[model samples]
Target: MAESFLFSIAESLIAKLASHAFQEASRLVGLYDNLRDLTKTLSLVKAVLLDAQQKQEHNHQLREWLTQLKTVFSDAEDLLDEFECQTLRKKVVKAHGSTKDKQDPGVLSIEDVGVCF
Candidate 1:
């Protein structure tokens, strides 16, 4: 009878140990799952940061191009203004030569026009 009692006690102890081991294993599994979730979150954050950096770089490049385009536009405007001024100057010189010729009754030669362009 004592042997049976001892065997029963041993079996109960083993059962308790098994239950504790199973609880510990479940806790470990939960911890592993949490770690896996954290890793995925970190990866997503890294991707977002990289994308933001690339966007910033692209914006910087666009700004630089805009500045260059503005400079080019300004230069084109200056050139057009210079061309208009030269054309007006030529027209004024031709009108002056025609008036002088009408007053003097002389044909105005190209050399007398003094127009360079």
Candidate 2:
């Protein structure tokens, strides 16, 4: 009977050890899966950061282009204004010359009534 009891006790100990080993193995697998997920998350974060950096560079370039375009537009406007002034001056000179030819000698000059600078 003693020998039988010893065998039973040994069997119980073996079963407990097996159950503990299984629990440990399950915990290790869970830890490994968590580590894999963390790695993936880190990779995704890195990709996002890289994309943001590229976008920032693009925005900087766009701002520079916009500034250059504004300068060009300002220069064009100034040139247009200068051209318009020249055309207006020519028209006024032509009109003045034509009016002078049509005026009578007895007429008083309109400029005589104005204050002299």
Candidate 3:
């Protein structure tokens, strides 16, 4: 159960990392390098998770560690969600302009944000 959950989270994060909106957001936020590193790290984690899942059947410590890792993955997922939301909001504002032309300080106004990758 834990393995499947973790696998799903990793897959979701990887998909988000590859998304056009997220890629643009990362570039605007100057996280292109960080995003590349994260992609590599998550690939490693997914590889290790397969072995860990098999071994965890007899190792209580490994199970506990997986639980802790789940929390970390949850936090990472939330962070990616925030970036995706901010990027999408910026796109909407740029397409239609903000309501009443009131600028949102939180949403960045980026023109022609090219993806680093």
Candidate 4:
């Protein structure tokens, strides 16, 4: 039960982060880079779930491992949430026409932002 719950949370987080838009606009600002890295790490975590689930129940240490993983997962999710919030902040700033100049491609256009990605 613990193993399944952990992996499912991991899977959901991965899917959430993976679904973000990393197009040319976001690429210029570097959100794409961070997103890519996090996605890769999450993908690796997802890949290991099968093996982890199989072993977690049998090994006493696996419960501790799960605890550690849960901590990491929580941290990663928080980071992603911060990243997303930053992105939205930028979009909001840009959409409000605060400092959206052509020279500042760092701010993704409102059109570029689709579903917080």
Candidate 5:
């Protein structure tokens, strides 16, 4: 059960790493090379998962390793999600400009009309 779950997470992480937004975000943050390395590592891990699954039942150490791996994969997925969100947020800010840079067009201050209290 743990093996299959870990395998799925590895696959999901790989797919996220390959996404265009994630790539662009990673490159902007100077993580492109690191992410590339990670992708390669994930592919290798994925390949090993099938074998590991078959053998884990007979090996206690392997089962422990898979559990640890599952935690790492979960962390990686969360990191990717955060990265993607930041990327999208930046895109939105670029498109709409910062809130600090914008003012409510319909609202006016009394000073603008030189009103006396």
Candidate 6:
């Protein structure tokens, strides 16, 4: 049961990363180059998830390894979510600029409107 649960989570993470929104987010956040690497790593993790789960019940070492993998997967998911949030925050800030950024008498502050990344 535990193995299947983790397997499902890995599968869902892979599905989420494959979407257009995630691709766009990756591009926006400068992870475009690493996206393929991430996919490959996830594929490996997914491939091992079931096997580890099945063996864990009888093997102590495999069970410990799967626990570690679960932590890694959770952290990876959080990082991906952070990048996507940053992308969305950028879009929102660009779309609706601050009053100061939009106008300041006659001069627009380049610093205010500039995106660091």
Per-residue lDDT tens digits for candidate 6, residues 1-117, read 666767877877788788788888778768877886778788887788767765777898888777777787788777767666666666767898655645757774544555333
- Structural similarity to truth (TM-score) of each candidate: 0.34, 0.34, 0.80, 0.64, 0.81, 0.72
Cand. 4 TM to true fold: 0.64
Off by over 4 Å in 4: 22-26, 31-34, 97-117
- Candidate 3 vs candidate 4: the TM-score winner is 3
Ranking by lDDT: 5, 3, 6, 4, 1, 2
**How far off is residue 108 in model 4, in Å?**
26
- Which candidate ranks first by lDDT, i.e. highest? 5
Instruction: Look at candidate 3 and give me any clashing residue pairs.
Output: none
lDDT tens readout by residue for model 2, 1-117: 222333333343334324444335436546545434544553453444344444645476644644453454445445434534444555667777645566787875444443222
**Per-residue lDDT over 1-117 for candidate 5, one digit per residue giving the tens place of the 0 to 100 score:** 888898899999999999998788778889899999999999999989989988998999998899899999999888778767667767867999765436576766443554423
Q: After aligning candidate 4 to the native by TM-score, how far in Å is the CA of 112 from where it should be?
A: 27
Superposition-based RMSD of candidate 6 using all C-alpha atoms, in angstroms: 6.7
Name the best candidate (by TM-score).
Answer: 5
lDDT of each: 0.45, 0.45, 0.83, 0.70, 0.83, 0.74
- CA shift of 101, model 5, Å: 8.3
Candidate 1 residues 1-117, lDDT tens each? 222333333343334323444335436546445434544553453444344444545476644644453454445445434544555555677777544555554766444775433
Cα RMSD (Å) between model 1 and the true structure?
40.4
Preferred candidate (lDDT higher): 1 or 2:
1
Q: Which of 2 and 4 is the better model by lDDT? A: 4
Poorly placed runs, candidate 3 (over 4 Å):
100-117
Pull out the clashing pairs in model 1.
none
